[model samples]
Structure formats: structure tokens, C-alpha cells
Target: MSRPGQSSRLLICCTALIVCQFVSQLSQAGVIRDKLMERRAQQSEMEEEEAATNGPRFKLPPGTRVLEDVAYGSDAKQKMDVYLPASAGDHSAVRLPVIFMVHGGAWAIGSKTHNKVVENKVARWLPKGFIFISINYRMLPQLLAREQAEDVARALAMAQSKAAEWGGDPDQFIIMGHSAGAHLISLLSTSPDMVAQFGVHPWLGSVSLDSAAYDIPAIMATKHYGFYDKAFGTDPAYWRRSSPLHALNTAGAPFLAVCSSKRPDHPCDQADYFVKRANAIGMRASVLPQARSHGDINQQLGLENSYTQAVEDFMASLSPAIRRHLE
Candidate 1:
């Protein structure tokens, strides 16, 4: 009933409306696709960063024997490399103290055999008659921070059960970890009850190497790296549960938190806070702030320097036998 010009105008309006809706939907889809691609790129960069930290494969030191790929759990990633001293021969009755080490890659990517994780420590400790253990646990996107701590506990329990076979004294165990691994060890040290559930006995002490994640709530409360969001989701209760500072209720083990002063994130401040809380609860805890990079804190730990001597001094304080070895 309308004029031809009016009908044409009506059709044009309808076409414009439809085009706008289609354009809006396309824009939304493009936004979603861009976000996903950005996430993938971030993950790729993270993996590359972790890979860069991995130096050459660890070369076995003379007179040290390593039992590689010792499975602690059903998962392929749940394995450990046990390095024994020469004194642990077939007929030797020597029971060496064990240094159980956990490597770090932001709780997502790392291997037990990473050279920085095993090389220097093995060179230094193996000659001193200590059994060194480097472990690999299921990483993020599969297991979160709390579950990762549980994996460490499981590995410890398995190692303790088989200590005699490797001529290691199950009673003389010291837990050590770097970066994210440091956070896990710190959590285990603070939450002895949780670890006890896994049949893990009390360790001699723990050495946390430059862990800023001791207080998860504190980190998440402020500006933090995106990876923390991945490791600790958007749960306040989970933050408290995963935080080492929040988990400390009783004195379980002595602790040494070695932090990097060079880091802008103030890892030493977190370490200080954790140590103070531990000391308040009658636990022997201290923080060592070194003027070094984060990577150097872990890499240069066993070299013949003041830094290594300082760490050795801490280990020496754990037991008279350990003291004798360093002396």
C-alpha cells in the first residue's frame, strides 16, 4: 500500500539493521579469538623462558653413581634422580645424609635433570658423602600449587622408604628448592600436618631459594605476574591454603629462606616475613638476602664462594655429622 520510494527506504533500513548486528557479532568473535591467541602466545613465551634456563644436560661427576628415573608415582613426570656418593658401595655400611632438591619453573615447566638444578649441587655435595635427590612433579594445568606440594610429599615418602637401598639415612633428610619449588617446600615446612598425612616424616630443615610466593594472598592482592593467576586461581580461600605464611601453625622444621636482593619484587621482604612468623612459633628460621640475580641464587649455590660457604654453614647447623662433612 506504500509508495515505491517509501518501500525502498524501509528495505534499506532493514538491511542496515541486519548489517549492524552481523558486524557486532563478528566484532565479538574477533575479540574472543584475539584473547585466546594472546593467551597461547603468553604460554609459548613462558615455555621459551623456562627452556632458556635449562642449560646443558648434567654430566655425572667421577665417583658418584646416579639412579635415574626412579618412579615415585604412577605418572611419568613423578620421578627422581638419586645421586649417591662413592662411599655407598655394594658392601659399604655408610649411610649418607640426603639432600632432596626440587627444581623451579613457575610451577609449570621444569625437569629434575636441569643442569642448574643438579650440576653444581652434585659436584659440591656428592664428594661430601651426601645423597642428592632431584625430583620432577606434575606441573600446572594438571595439578595446582597445593597438589604440587602433595606431590613433593609423596616423592619424599617414597625416597624415605627406599633410603636403605641407596645407603641413605632416612632420618637425615634436608629439603631444598628454588623459586616455585621454594614456595612448595616452604608450604610443606609450614603445613606439617598436611605432609604427615602422606606418611612423610619430619625433615631436618628446608632451604627455600628466592621464593616470593610465600604469601600467596599478599602477592595476589597486589600487582603480580600473570603466571601467579594460573598457579593460584581466583579463590581467596585457596590463596590462604596455598600460602606458606598462612599455613604456619606449629614448628615442624628449621628453615633457611635465601632471597635475591636484586629482584624488584622484594623476595627478601617475603622471606623476612615468613622467617619472623616461624621464629614467633619457636621454629629456627632465618632469611639470607644475597645481592645477586634470581638465577644466580640457584646456579651459584654450590660454587666455591662466600655464598656457597654461607649455605654450607646453614646445612652444618642441622647436624654434627653434616658439620663434620663441611669442616
Candidate 2:
């Protein structure tokens, strides 16, 4: 029981185990470092990929093609592309009223140019004297959802600065987005704090959203969007701070929220919620139910989805003269 040689051997074995543990820790750290590097590289690649794609191209008035380059704000989200209409004077009837369109990608991935229904033949509306402007904004992981809302505010402000130049009336600003972008529009519509920061009055009109997220708390409560935890993390306060339903009021402007079905239990529950509350106040609100999936509701924009009629009807109802003055 007191053999000196045996004691030395046992000590050596213990030391070896410690050394092995240290080595394993080092390997794990290296793997983590490598993965982070890979992820950063992939994100860089994605930005370049988005940059390489030419934004929407159009035939400007008087047979001129003009691609406008605008420097929006401090962040890169301050960028946008303007498609001018052919031969119409600044604020002319033919110059096409501008619709500040935002794209959908769960507030993570999307480019304004990437979602051009007018470019694609799925449904044609460019000839309707409409000028479509899609803009990019900071997304989650890189920025908070609130910060992304700031980017939208900046985009609209920047548009306002050049309203006369683009023949767009400052009062006729039309805000629209899909999915998270729609959430963003709703957020901006309701959040007076965010709107006042833009240094302008509220906008004129809105057109179309498909299965957009309206209530942040309600959506997070679902806890089944596959990326909910990753997006906002598991913080309850964070969810409450970002929900649009919490901030929305009758003071918000008139807009339409569309869903796949008129029923309350549809997957796009936010649209239903918006319709219900909006109608309670006698606000000029409307909802056109569709039996399409979330993705189908959105991608259906350039296609033969039933949502087209709603968009057409809504747009047609707008006073053309008033739309022209939207900045």
C-alpha cells in the first residue's frame, strides 16, 4: 500500500489525463474559429453577389434610360434605385407616381431589385403610370429590428428630399413591403417615435402586403417559425418591445392587409388582426383573403395570384392627382 514506485506511476497517469484535456480544448477553440471565419466569408460573398446583380432596368421618358444613384444615409441601407418614367415633366401626369416598395426576406436577406414584378410578365403594372422604387435596409444579426425600421425611415426621408426631382409629390409617398418588410412598414406606420425622426409628416397611401407579421409578441409566442429563437433570441422583453400591434392606432394611415383566407385562424394571423382592429375604428381599411401559402402570397405578386386584383383595385382607387404629389 505504500510502494514509492507505484505512487510515481499513478501520478504520471493523472498528468497524462490533464494534458489530454488541454489538447481537446485547444482543438475545440480552433474549430470554432474556423467556423466563424467561414461564416464571415460567406456573408461577404453574399454582399458581392447582391452587388453584381443589375437592379431593375427601364425605358425612361423621351426614350432615355436613366439609372439613378442615390446616397441615402450613414448605413448602406440608405441606398435605393429609381426607375423614371418616359418623357413626363417633373410632377407631370405621365412621369409615373412612385411607390416606395420594400422587399421581403424575413428582415434577413433581400434586395429591392430582386423583387420586380413589373420587370417580369407575371403581372404587368409599369404601364399603369407607376414608378416603383425598392430599397435595401439593415437586417437582424447585423442590426436590431428597430434599427432596420430606422433605415426605412431614412429611405423615405431621402425620397422626400428628391420628390420634386423625381416628379413624386412629397404627400403621395406609398409605403409597401412583403413579409418582414411588411412588418417594417406597419411598424413605421404605427411608431410615431420612428416617424418623427424622419423629419416629415406621415405618408399618403399604402398598397399590398402578403402574410406579413403584425404582432411581434404573438409571433414569438408561436415559437415555431424555425428561426424565431435565432432571430430575436429567447428574451420576452425583446419580443414585446418590437410588436407592431402594441403601437398601431387609428391615427395610422389607411392601408390594406391581405391574407389567404378570410377566417381568423389562417397562418397569416397578423393580417386578420390588422383587418379586425382597423375596421373597429372605421378606418379606411380593407383585406382581401387568399388561399395561398405565405410564399405563394408573396411570389404570386408577379404571377396570377388572386392578390393582383386587390393591388389593382387599391391602386386604381387612389386619386391620380393626389398620388402624383406623394413625395
Candidate 3:
């Protein structure tokens, strides 16, 4: 109904409107993405700050004392914090059992003093006259997974050497860790000779919390996170060297592998496989499946619940003295 010039003018206006709308949508999407990134950055900062400064959230039982930054190696990260009960002193004859803890952050990040690492655990165990030790180790880009295990061994040796000074038993240590820490303790349990080389005596047992990396070669064979590759690398030989399942040859110590039933990765299945092998070789080993998330498996362990009770039962089985403390 219009002349050519008028029709052409109408078409240009329509195209301009469509283009403007598209640009507006793109701008909105960019803004949303920017906001999301900003929120994530803020959250990361908050977590770092908390990990740096936060202590146990619960009140310390009366007379509980802490010795911070007890160095095992020359590196600053190779330090541990020792928590002592009121009963622990040079003058006291009572020798407390030790719980040596390793924190988990994919083998790359985490601290000894993170609230989740020490809060409920310190509250529960210190009151029971247990000596709780939380350690920090050199992490990824600085040390490989195998090297980290060595750091753990070094820390154990140091803790054992100083046990009497802190009113703890040198032979009654229970090595416990969560996530990547779990993987490290599992590796050491499987390779007792490696720990022995570091002058560490035999520990009582090990408790591994929600570790899926027991079989490194198996994990690398399937779909996995990029972090695993970063930690284990591309060599199958290195995978075997780092794998707990592959490294396990002889009986070392009693073990408890606690796994999360909620993860799609089937951590329980891996735990079961490791336990089966351990039991076959005249070792006391078991897998406990819990309906907890990966983080909760570590965070909720020392809380007054069935989970804590079960762990304490395992501790009791280690020795009569430990049983008495739990009682």
C-alpha cells in the first residue's frame, strides 16, 4: 500500500528495533554473569579468611590448652597444632591417646585450624582426655601427592618424638583424615615401610573419611575431575605409586574407611574394595557407608551422633585404655 521509499524506510525501522532488543538482552546476560562471578569471588575470600583465623566454634572445656605451630619440617606448611586436655601435663602420669588429623582440600588447599577441621572434634575428644593434633602440609604445585604422604609421615614422626612432653602415648596414635587427607593416610597405611623409613613407629590404626582416590589408576581410567589429573599426572606408573589399593601388599594396621553414600562416584564401592583386600591379608578393616555429603562426612564426625559413636567404637577396639576414655 506504500511507495518503495516509504516501504524501505519502514523495513529499516523494524530491523533497528530487533537489533536493539537483541543488544539489550546480551547486556542483561553479561550483567548477570558479572554478578555471579563477583559473588563467587567474595565467597572464596570469606572462606580463605575463615580458614586463616577461625578456631573451634565450640567452647573449650575448662583447662584445655593448645600448642600451635609445632614444626616438623623446615617449610612453614609442615607444622601441626597440638591440643591437650586438662589431664595432660609434664607432671601428670596419665598418657593420653593421640588423634593425628589431616585436613582435606583436594590435596591443594586447607589448613590445620579451619573451623571444620577442629571444632566439633576438639570439643568432643579433648573433653574425653584425648590429645588431638591437626597438621598442615605442603600442597599441590609445591608437592605431589606422594610427597604429601611423606610430609604426613614426617609429621607423625615428630608428634611421636614429642608425645611424652605433651603427655601423650607414642605408640597409641590413630591417624585420621578427610577427603584428600583420607587418601594420604590410606596410602601410608598401605605402605608401612615408607613410614618406617621416616622413623615413624607403627601407629595403632587409620580412619579415612570419604576418599574416592584409593585406586588412582582406576580413577584415571574413567571420567574424573581435572584436579585428579593435576594431582596424579598422566603416567600410569605414577598412578600405581600413588594408589593405596595398588600399594597395599602386607598387613599394616587396622583401618576404617568411611564413605559417603550420597556421592555419584560410588566412594563406598571403592572403600569396600580396599577393605576386602585389607581383610584378606589378615588385617582388621571395614567400610562404613553413611548417608552424608562429602563435606558432612568430615564436618559432622565429632558431633554427638551415631557416626561419632561408631568411630569411637573403632577407637575402643584398638585398646582397652582408649575404651576407658570413650566410656
**Which candidate do you rate higher for TM-score, 2 or 3?**
3
Off by over 4 Å in 3: 1-50, 54-58
Higher lDDT: candidate 1 or 2? 1
Report how far off residue 216 is in candidate 2 (Å): 1.2
Please give, for residues 73-145, the per-residue lDDT of candidate 1 as tens digits: 9998898889988887557665789999998888888778777788899999988888999998988999998
State candidate 2's TM-score: 0.72
lDDT tens string, model 2, 132-235?
A: 57677877688767678778888888887786677655666677776667777877877778788887467766655663456767777762343345556667
lDDT of 3 by residue, 32-63 (tens): 87666545433322231244643554577789
Clashes of each: 0, 13, 0
Candidate 3 lDDT score at position 284: 95
Query: In model 1, which runs have C-alpha deviations exceeding 4 angstroms?
Result: 1-56
lDDT, residue 46, model 1: 33
